[model samples]
Target: GGAFKETDRGQWAHVVCALWIPEVRFANTVFLEPIDSIETIPAARWRLSCYVCKQKGVGACIQCHRNNCYAAFHVTCAQQAGLHMRMDTVRDSVTGAETQPVIVQKTAYCDAHTPSISGLTPNANYVEDTISEKTREESRNKMKQARKMLAKKRSSVPVILIPTIPPERVQEIATLVSITKKAQFIQRLIAYWTLKRQYRNGVPLLRRLQSQGQTHTGFGARNGIEGSPDTSELYHQLKYWQSLRQDLERARLLCELVRKREKLKVALLKTHEEVVMMRLNPVEMAMIKLLDVLFQKDSNEIFNEPVNINEVPDYMDIVKHPMDLSTMRTKLYSKMYYSLDDMEA
Candidate 1:
């Protein structure tokens, strides 16, 4: 009688069989005995069979090609042997890993069924090296291009010298000139004022005077007098006129410069006003228009203090051109003095 015992490994029904090779049997030897022999075995007597298909066999129990589990099967059984055997320990081409199961055919498993595992070694390091080299090359090329572009840009830039006329020099020159001596000052002022003139007026005058003096020895080059003055006297007059002309020109430049600066200031203010108005809310625009109309009414009242009929004639004439009024209104609005709604009213 066989005794069933649960071992440390798992449950097993052990039976002492008539020993065929007693000398080879070790004390630890645990034989896994099949329930039936193939010759006397009925379909019901085959208790354990192939894990893959439950078919009967004893010769060489083929392990499951998928899970490597012992699944006994006969060589000539209806079920095919090695159906899921992986002959080659290859990785799947799609997955790039060894986890994929290889499907075997009825024929001997070849590279066709079990894919070649030879070239499965990862080339990540090679790819990374190539990419790094390419990146370095591109970076180098970009740096070279940047350097070239900067050099070209630098080479193309033109040098301009902005003349800095000192304000103190301008003030000093203005003090020397009298408002009463207009014509004489205007003539003398040509040299200083026209020094930087686009046309060669100052240079032309100097050249003509020099030429005339050379032609006629009696003519004085410095003062343009009929007879030649002494060298020292001519030199002294020349130096005086030169200094005076420089001062006068500086004064004229200062006046013109002030006018230009005022114009620029007005233009900048207009631009800022336009930007602000463009972003203003509708309510703000309406308020601005009302303020502008009120300011205009006040200005008119101030001008007409004691309200003369003769003075009103000039005022009426000024308002004759509607287009001119609109243009003036637009310019005033650009300076934030009025709004479009004010002009409408």
Candidate 2:
């Protein structure tokens, strides 16, 4: 209420007042009680939208008494908006009346409900309006502000603190982007989304680099992305930014690897039974059966028991580590290998 004066009702009281609302005149102004009932206003006024607040069912509202104008509003709202609150005074008959005279009727009118200077037109109701001039006036003001802002437009992206890229580089990127269709010569270069995303990311990165000093320089420097000092930060600071950018890039790559590892883990779990069976080494009997092939790696004597050193005296020297298929069968029955990997090893 710094700029506002307190009324008879007190500071900010009129806004909350139920009796002091539009279409509600005080029957006894002395105590400001015994207000004119809301029943006095037409039901249509209650239903009509209030142009000022654009809401209904809040309080008693007054409407444009000008015929067919459904415009309704709170009294305070109407007064602030400068709508015509016409009062017809009772003149000369009453002797006890004050010099100000007696107001017999109080009526409100909208912008479109102004009195005709010539005479009453045939379609006076059509000329009258509701949800009228006040709402339109506000809309018009907002439209004017937007128009003013639009006047200072430019094609180039504006820089608040630091620009994303050098103006020339941005222009080069723009030239490449302007041609969207695939051209054999520029097929690799025409990455519209990549260019846009990098440009978008560069904006915040430049701001961070500028604010954080040399901490983020090394990363962008290694990648040859940081520009001249005239375009961005100094050389050493750019180098620090390059380091930071590289660290962040590594972090991004590691995150992708971790995601793939988790997916692989889930896949392994789904086929856990098959893997377990493979590790069980159930091929011991199969290997024994395969040994039946006669003299496959050497002589057919391998199917029978080992030849004794007594019969062939050179056997102890030549076949010092010999073991026949029958000996292998005995080892398999003894459970020497628990898994296929162990058996192969």
Candidate 3:
């Protein structure tokens, strides 16, 4: 009833539509049948959902490789079903070589379709029990060797001949002995040098004293100069000479004796001044004063009193006529006072 064209032949009404007597009774008259068959373009390589749980195969899963079969199942579902696996050969057309056999899962069928086995055969794989036994044997041998080495180390030395002193103590003993010997040698050298110095100074002093007809007093009190002869002997000798001068009426020789005594007194006073100056430090002066007071027995006089020029007696006043030993003894103290007065002045 619509526009008729040769291209719209089956596109309009199929030939089977004419089988109906009225053709209006047939469904094809209202809706035309497909003009051409569906084109089979190799099925588009689609991923099959798991046949057991019907979930998308996202993890380790297996697919049925039976003829015209596209059933898939997860690996745990396959193992629980106890299905047997088979191998299929796939050849690479570009390399013209057969690749390794690919495993084909047969888990789509139930236990009725496939036989089930409990465990894998030992001869089928080598890594499980065989490798574990070998590793255990190696570990045992290593432990045994370690234990033997520890035993040998513990019993390395004999029990009877153990050392009395530790090695470190023996070394320390040797060090101490060497140190003591070194110290003794140094001390001996110091003593030898000190004695040699004393001998060098003492010989000359002894010789000088012998020349002066006097005995050496160990070493000199000041600078190793010979000390004066015995005081008592000199006094007696001077008196004898003074008496001879008077008996011979020699006034000049008497004067010379008086001059000699004056010189002795002067020397004594100079020595006293040097000692006082040496103790001038406040600490030394105080200590000397304290000791003098502590050790004093009867006298209350201060030991280191300051000199007074006015208290000092004149030399001429004490020795107005120095003639013999009788006058000399009395005048000796006067000379001491005069020397002190001179120092104060």
Best by lDDT: 2
Local distance difference test, each candidate? 0.43, 0.53, 0.41
lDDT of 3 by residue, 1-345 (tens): 122211133334323222211212222222333222212111322244544444453332345534344555544434333444433344435531332233322223322223233233223133233446555465446445544554564469533321134547645555655555765665564556456546554332345444343323322322433344664455456567757855664456567668867876777787687588556644443433444444464255432243333775574477563242223223433442233233223
State which candidate, 2 or 3, has the greater lDDT. 2
Ranking by lDDT: 2, 1, 3
**Whole-model lDDT for model 3 versus the true structure?**
0.41
Q: Residue-wise lDDT of candidate 1 within 229-308, one digit each (tens)?
A: 45446556666886796688668768977986787777778778867875875545665565566657765445323334
Lowest lDDT 10-mer window, candidate 2?
1-10
Error of 1 at 66 (Å): 99
Q: Tell me the TM-score of each prediction against the true structure.
A: 0.20, 0.26, 0.15
Q: Of the candidates shown, which would achieve the greatest TM-score relative to the real structure?
A: 2
Tell me the tens digit of each residue's lDDT in model 2 across 236-294. 65567757966886687689779867876776675685467546754764554455453
